[model samples]
Target: MPQNIYLEDYTLVQPHSNFVIAGGRVFIKKWTSLSFNCTIVTGNHKPTVGLNQRIIERLHINDIEKDVVIGEDCWVGANVTILSGTMLGRGSVVGACSLLNKSSPPYAVLVGTPAKIVGVKFSLEQILKHESNLYPEHERMSRDELEVLFEKYYKGLKSMGTDYLSPEEKMKSMQYANMQYKI
Candidate 1:
């Protein structure tokens, strides 16, 4: 059983049974909030040639294990089930009763059974300002200071290393991408 769990500061997790099990890691970064009845499972029974669903009968097959990473400033709502190999990036918000089975980019607002990215919590510019304010006590910065801040903070969670697209731009991109799916 692997016991390499990393929970950072200012994390709030509500009471629940079997919240996190052993045999893998669960890294919940700083400023995260997990609501009640949330389960983070890190191991799953591997499918075998035999049609036995019982673990005892499938003992010859090894279980698949992977880490679950919930990044900083995240909000996981009630009854969320995060499976193995899932990565919820920084500043994400998972809505209630969501089943997160895939990785998400930073600041993604996810909902539904498979947990699709609906939107982001804040704009990149605002997030940059928020991060700058966090560095030294929440205070406004001068123009030059802001420039320096951007230079340093651009590499961090605030910037996804891409241009912040407008809604129309996003729609266009999605439309272009969806063309591949058409028969």
Candidate 2:
């Protein structure tokens, strides 16, 4: 398929430079929010090419073009820069001013230049508990998967309570009714 920007419902990607500088392809899935001053670049200039040809060569080269894919329920903080070929997993949380050049796992908390996985957004128990009733049975994160992530990025049983889920009704099956869907 041809490369193009594909935005699903409830995804907010702030305007980038007012114009497409590189015309790179981007796909932002649902429930994702990108903050201000963020840049997602899909085009990379070939270093071997001569100065004059570098700019033109990047657009022509088949391998130089790569698309950026942001998964669902991701929150990308302000001043972040995501380079080409980056795929942020679902529920990824990138901190402000981070420079992400590669992909990330689900619920990863990324921060700093050349963003690193600082930690996961929530503890394993909390995440599992939170996702149980919200997402469907099949769509929910499997225990095996969560366990592995727990070993890797898990800290402790943090924020496992539902007190923050005020109004209570919001923790139901995800539908189109409650979302703003746009910035």
| TM-score top scorer | 2
Question: What TM-score does candidate 2 reach?
Answer: 0.76
Instruction: Work out the TM-score per prediction.
Output: 0.67, 0.76
Candidate 2 stretches greater than 4 Å from native:
1-3, 15-24, 49-63, 154-163, 166-177, 180-183
Error of 2 at 156 (Å): 8.0
lDDT of 1 by residue, 1-183 (tens): 236767877677888924454467888887788999899988787677655768623463567778999987789999999999899977778999999999986667788999887666655566565455343434333456545534443333332234467999978867754322221
**How would you encode candidate 2's per-residue C-alpha lDDT over 99-155 as one tens digit per residue?**
899998888888888998877777666677756644667788997998887676655
Clash-forming residue pairs, model 2 = none
